[model samples]
Target chain A: MNKILTIMWKDVRVLFQDWAAVALIIAGPLVLALGLGLVTGAFSNSDAPTIGRIPVVLVDEDGGQLAAALVDVLTSDDLSDLLAVETLSDADAARARVAAGDASAAVLIPTGFSDSFTPDMATGEMPASVTVTVVGDPGAPVGAAVVRSIVEEFAARADTAVAGVRVGLTQLAGSGAVSPVELPAVGQSMAAAVFADSAAASAASVIRVETRNVTATGESFNILAYFAPAMALLFLMYAVTLGARTLLSERREGTLARMLAAPVSSAQVLGGKVGGIFLGGFIQLAALILLTTLLWQLNWGNPLSVLLLVVAAALAATGWGLLIASLAANAGQITSLGMALTLLFGILSGSFVPLNDAWPVLDWLSRITPNRWAMDGFVALAAGEGGAAVLVPVAALLVMAAVLFAAAALFFRRRQGALLTA
Target chain B: MTTPILIAKDLRKTFGDLEAVKGISFSVLRGEIFSLLGPNGAGKTTTINMLSCLLPPTAGTAEIAGHAIPGDTLGVRRAIGVVPQEIALYDALSARQNLEFWGRLYDMRGQALTQRIDEVLEQVGLADRAKDKVKTFSGGMKRRINIAAGLLHKPQLLFMDEPTVGIDPQSRRRILDMVKELRDGGMTVLYTTHYMEEAEELSDRVGIIDQGRLIALGTQAELTRVVGEQETLRLYLAEEAGAAAAQATVAAGDGAALPADGGLTLFNGLPGVLRASAIDHQIVVNVADAGEALPAVVGRANALGLHVRSVDIEEPNLEAVFLQLTGRGLRD
Candidate 1:
């Protein structure tokens, strides 16, 4: 509608009126992405940034089967091209090596690491978790990240093997292929034997994908590709929140009432505000993508897919912004909560660091935020997963948008009798 | 005479148990300035909000330019322009931009919207500052542009709800003149203000509102008539003389016998003087003839060793009428 467009036009013009805000929403992220890229050394003339094989020390504190087996994985053929592996008996020695910049990172396998992984029949702890500490030097950021990524890749494959065994054993007991009374003992023995110091066997019968594969594009994990979308999305929440909060500000300023007093309906006003935020977010995203591509020389593949991703990301973020605006009691609340949520989403979505190469729990938790979907789509594009590869994340983003929008609509209706400022 | 531009029959609005606008009604003839004269919290702004379709009445009905309220909210909104008590222009935008933005909302576009924006900017005398951001403008300039925003679409009826509340006198004067010009050009207006002088200076018919009800509605002459043939002669006395004069008069008894002496006696004996009361720094005389009583009052004050600092004579006004109706001063 003309009225809706008019409303959006007014809002957008108002948003652009403050040059500082425009700069903050657009250029701030561009600088951060580039700065982080330079910090991580994710820029180069090649299709991907190049870093030589990083020197890594593997410290096996636990002489258990899992620790020895994981150390074997660190020295495995798949990681040998990117990592020069060394054995350290003491974690302190490994830490000293990394701190001295003699090594990119040190992977310390703590005591009880494998003992936890082996199912305990008496303790009844079926799915076990143990912390694997990776200490990295600030001097070798990308190499350190790569070293850390390899350990996570090995851990992921082991987790898959254990989970597959548990599921199979549970099914067997249920189907009477194995006696119910013997299921726990059967699982404990199978797990203990599989991961024992002598048997370093990993299962292939379960669904698995190589966590990080150095593909044909000459690209490895680049920080700029990750941070560009991460920082952009982090501030995109703010820009959208800023836009949404103005609806309340305008209401207090009497401009909203004045507009409502005109030949305009409430729906038109909402359409304009939501549309303005949606469009502003997309512009910010596109501009950041372009600016990062130019400034950092980063490859964000499949232009069409990137555009689609930006739109979907904007939709999901704007929907959240509207939901926050509706639920927030005032402008101050919207601002503070928006900022807090942005940081939270950023941290949870692995914007600062890839959660994929970190804890599996955190990686799973990232799914709840739109930033995760957006980051996943962007990371996919960066890795040369063409247009169609991004569809799953885009679909995920749209579903989030639909859910958030429905909730926002319900809240808006409930609060309709009161003004936005209220 | 042809048809009323706006009419309301028993419009009511309640927020919880507190009734903001009681069941009340009035009509505005085409091309007339109908002023709602009331102090703050007398439901003036609430009434303006209701008539402008900014607030839906809890009960009753109304029609603006033949379009009904609530049921035809969009229609009513289309027929009216509302300049709220607050200066509602976007401070971030330019004067011209603010006008253009609001103009488009009223459905004007392209050259017509541009031309109308220019016309309204010029109308409010802000044509020169069209490009300057409104936040950079002076308060009066902002108020002018605020009014300019409302005038963009040239609606059939305009609602100016205390548009001159907090501004310099020069700007207030300009806005008053602009309101008159709009009415002269055949635009019906519903103006609300607590200032009796503003209502007296602008309205063809005044509606005196008090506590959610219209207490009186008539022309200036009719409203003034409510207080009767009365003139107040305010004789400002010196600070020391204020209490002395009143005590002197009370001692002199009834202020009618003249005390058979001189000094304050002459004030009691002044012809057409009905009652002389001194309070604070001013001696007020309710008189039958102000013109004839002024000289004698001043002479008596001088004779009584009371310095007549200044003197003022006021004709009975809507303030007096409001006092007679509500038993309290309008400003009270």
Candidate 2:
């Protein structure tokens, strides 16, 4: 244990001695968070940095039942506090409003949008698909994403309703309950009722949460609370990578062999390396949180939970670092793979953008990265949620750390002879 | 007789089909500087690694300070100190800090570790630079600290593997002197080097290895006796003369001699000349007596139209012993 600590201390010392690495891994995130916060007007004391009512223009060319349902859902009382809806006649003009940044997004309902949902009896098949397009502003990604989510939900429910009606009509035709000539009319009637029912249910549930949230928090959300942890978690990976790099560098320089030659076991040596990486990451996160609090006056909520989240996040990030080191052939390879993983994880975890609900696939994939879980916990905490809100994210981060550490250990064990040999 | 501090029996290591160490064995007596002398890739470092427990031998057994290799690895490691061929000290750390870390790994702590660090630093002649980062030190200074780290725990045995490599002559001399001091202070060192001169100067007993085999092992006098009553006559020829001699010798086609070795085997059967070989610009001829063989050797070179710039007759040394045993110079 003493030997492990000794090696750990040595590795940490080496990591900090490289001034360039220290600046890159520690100070770089602080600067970026501050800059992003300023740009996003997160520091404005008069107004909270909440994603308030999103401005959206609707161009309903369909003039059909389904299009009217979508317009109703968007302009519903439940979403009134979340989305500021407007009606436009021209599709091109609605898109222009989005492009001009006058609105967060524009929902363009095509001319034959509703006709696609009804089947023709002669063909016994659905009409050619006409898609509804949501043109979003590049500047307000969160607001634009919210508007897009609503449209996507409406489309998904309509598709399900049509499919349900098709199944019902097919069964009715097989049972000789309806004639083939009347099948199309029956399918259209069933589809409209199913679509309206599902749309109302989905809208009531999904749109209700937004209204309740805005009301409960009084539209208060700290943007820095999001960017601060996002930036910190992004660079925490870099810090652990830098630490993991020393495992190979020390071997190349003969220091690893020197350590192994002492009374220390290979387990002790590796344990120290793992501990060192975790410690480096932990210090980087804790220091960033403290610095951002002092410099940016950002509150990270529930000190105990924040500390635990930092530890779990650092542990998971260090596990990734170890996995990269174990797979890489040398210090140079570790650096290349580490940098690539850092950036890839940063983008995937929505460190630069809130993407937790952007796409279902993206949200699921983001679960594999520590940045996502840490960011979620931090964002929740910043929104004035209690410590209980971080429980799931913390648990997920711990599980990620365990699995990655086990995999890295197996790899290290296989290469133990090659690595520890002179 | 002195007790053997380290004993090995048929230690061998094979990397796939390549046999790096081919079942060779020897022992080092307590309180002696036992040098393993060989050329590069000659299994000297491999032997050191195996004994130090860094690598397990494939087909042999060895014990260091009563700790067996492969079984009691922790025990062996605890009893031994390894100064690797590379300057292994952390360049980002100060000399004292690096020593402190290595010392603690050996379970040294508190005042004892601190005082031991100071002692080792002073012994390496870098006490004044203890606080300076290792990167700020010269190549020689780093090498000294590298050795100092190994000496921190004051183990029963120290393995210094080619410690003087790539350093200036003055620094190499200082390290040599430091090794002598350690030996005089009752330290047992297992030193490995490719330099014959270093072995000749440092080893109380020398083991000459080649092609993963221990060709010869004895005291300097004992090993030199392998080339009984032989003297090396070194003939330094001018560049043109050397090249001309090499071409002529190859044209003669005595025994597939390479021109890179100067191919100087013209005086094979000269009176009192036992054998002849070439190294660089000098042709070395092993003879029974320099006085009897010099005239004929020089005359033979002249007959071959080779100009002899100067000549020197050297006493039998480790190089001559290696040449006699393996038919090649230690640097080959």
Candidate 3:
């Protein structure tokens, strides 16, 4: 145990003494994570323009009073504010404009404008129903809905004005204040027509829209809260790879063989190396997490849960480093192989991107990589859930670490004699 | 006596089909500098490695410091210190640090470790530069540190394998002196080198190996005795000396009659000359007494109208003995 401690101390001292190693281990991950987070945030913020204006084109075919009233309502400020209204000469032209993406929808009023408003005509089967053709862009559903609301408001206001005159006549008859012959003529007049037009326009101005973004579960998307865990796990992988370089350096310098020649057993030597790298990896992760929190205002959920995740992540990283070093012959080979594998696992594990929307094959592949489990654990912790939910992934990570560490130990034991000779 | 510090009885080692050491055997008494002298591929290093238990032999056995090879490899490893030909010190570490590291490996620690490190540093004459990294040190300094690291454990038997392969003359001398000094202090050493002078100067018993076989093993004088009692007297004749002039020099005075080989004039029942040969404008006179015949041969050459450029009298030595035994030079 003393020998193991001595070896461990020497390794730690060497790593700390090296400026390049320290910088890469600590500062490298912080820089990469913060840079990627800020850049992605900037792009998402800039590209997602909020819904403000809906474009619509109008086609007024009737030359009569009713047509003029409907057109007035459609062109009023209340409707125009929600929909950018463009006047087109014909229904065909309006449809063309909508198809060209210049408009969200088109409202076309037919020729029978004043006829539909007469009391007898309204009571009987309405002639041609004062048809208003509505054309809309297929893709712009919100713009189409805004246009529909405006048209509905105009129709309801016209119907209410017609009903008010009937109510007044009925009340006068019931009171017996005057005979039916003494009543004013019910034929359409210019003043009444103009007054009706003004009423429709005024009613359109009074219409109000209250849109509520309601989800099935009543939760809105929070970008920062969603991606913070993934970014942390990615940086953790970077830390692990950087820390693993120590193993390759020792092997290249023959210092490892020199250490083995001491009275320390092979297990002690392996343990010391693993412990040193594990500590280095954890330090890097802690620095990255601190920097991310300070710079991006990242909330890492519960402190205890985050700490547990960090520890398990460090162990898994140490195991991965050992496994890579054991298989490589030299430092360059180790770095190349480690970089490739880390990238592969990181992508499959959704460290850089979300795996939920990823291809099905990739989702399955994530299950086999420790990085995926690590990321899952981070997500659970970041979501303010008791990391108890992350126990399976944490256990899986621990098992992976044990398997890799054991393989590395076995490799070292088998090659112990040959290494001495070398 | 006292179970000989190291013993190898007909040890053999083969790498695949090639036999590197073929049944070579020797023993080293305690507190002696035993050397194995051979050319580069002559199985010296292979034999030393087997003795040090760094490599296992294919056949036979070696007991190092009273422990058998393979059977007691760990004991043998603990009992012997190996200074390999290559510089194996850590380049990134200081001399003292390297010593401390090796000391800890050998189970020395704390004050005792520091004390040993200081002592070895001073012994290697690197105490002033002990804190400097080894890569910054000179070749000689690195070699000294290499030797110092090996000596940290204070083993009973030390193996120095080609310790002076490439170095300045002063450094080589210093190393040789250090080896001798260590042996004088009751340390048994098995030193191997191809340089015959190194062997002649330091070894108590020298073994000559060639092509994975031990061809000669004995003291310097014993090996020299193999060349017999004949002495050679050579006279460098002038460029213009002809065959008649050479014949006249050989035939003068107490020199005997000529032999059937015309170039060689054999003198029997003479006072000094036993055989004479002339080739390439130079004459070699084999005499019974080089001390007596050299002057006489020079005088005869001067009298025969042959101007002697130079004259040399030589006695048989290890080179001649090696040549006689193996029909090739020691280096070959």
TM-score of each: 0.77, 0.81, 0.55
lDDT of 1 at A10: 79
* Stretches of model 3 off by over 4 angstroms after superposition: A1-27, A34-38, A41-356, A359-394, A405-422, B1-3, B41-49, B52-54, B165-174, B195-197, B223-332
Weakest lDDT window of 10 consecutive positions for candidate 3 chain A: A207-216
Model 1 residue A123 lDDT?
A: 43
Give fnat for candidate 2: 1.00
Task: Give the residue spans of candidate 1 off by over 4 A.
Answer: A37-50, A55-81, A87-221, A350-365, A420-422, B233-309
| lDDT tens digits, residue span A1-422, model 1 | 99888888778888888898998998888888778777776655555565667799888878887777777666665556667899988999988997787988889998888777766775435645788988877566457656665676667877877887688787887899888667778887777656653433432222122435453334565667777888999999988988888868888788988988988888888888899988888888888888878876778888999999999999999998999988998888899888988888888886776544335677688887889998878876776666887898899999999999999999989988776311
Best by lDDT: 2
lDDT of 2 by residue, A1-422 (tens): 87778878888888889899899978899889878877876655565456667899999999877777788888987778788999999988998898798998889999889889888757668999999988777566656756775687678777876787889999999999999888988887786665456545545543223334334445444566777888999999999999999889888988888888888888888999999999889988999999988876778889999998999999999999999999999999999999999998988887786553325577688889999999878876765668997999999999999999999989999998888777
Expressed as tens digits, the lDDT of each residue in B1-332 for candidate 1 is: 34799998898988899998998799998999999998788998888888888788899889998899869988898889888888888888888888888988988989999988888888888889999999998888888888888888998999999999889999999999999999998898999998888999999999999999998998999998876887877777777444576455566454663332112233556887755544456666666789988888888777666788899898988766775576444554
Question: For model 2, what is the error of residue A126's alpha carbon versus the real structure, in angstroms, after optimal superposition?
Answer: 26
Query: Which candidate's DockQ is highest?
Result: 2
Candidate 2: deviation at residue B108, Å? 0.8
Candidate 2, which CAPRI tier?
Answer: medium
Position B175, candidate 2: lDDT: 100
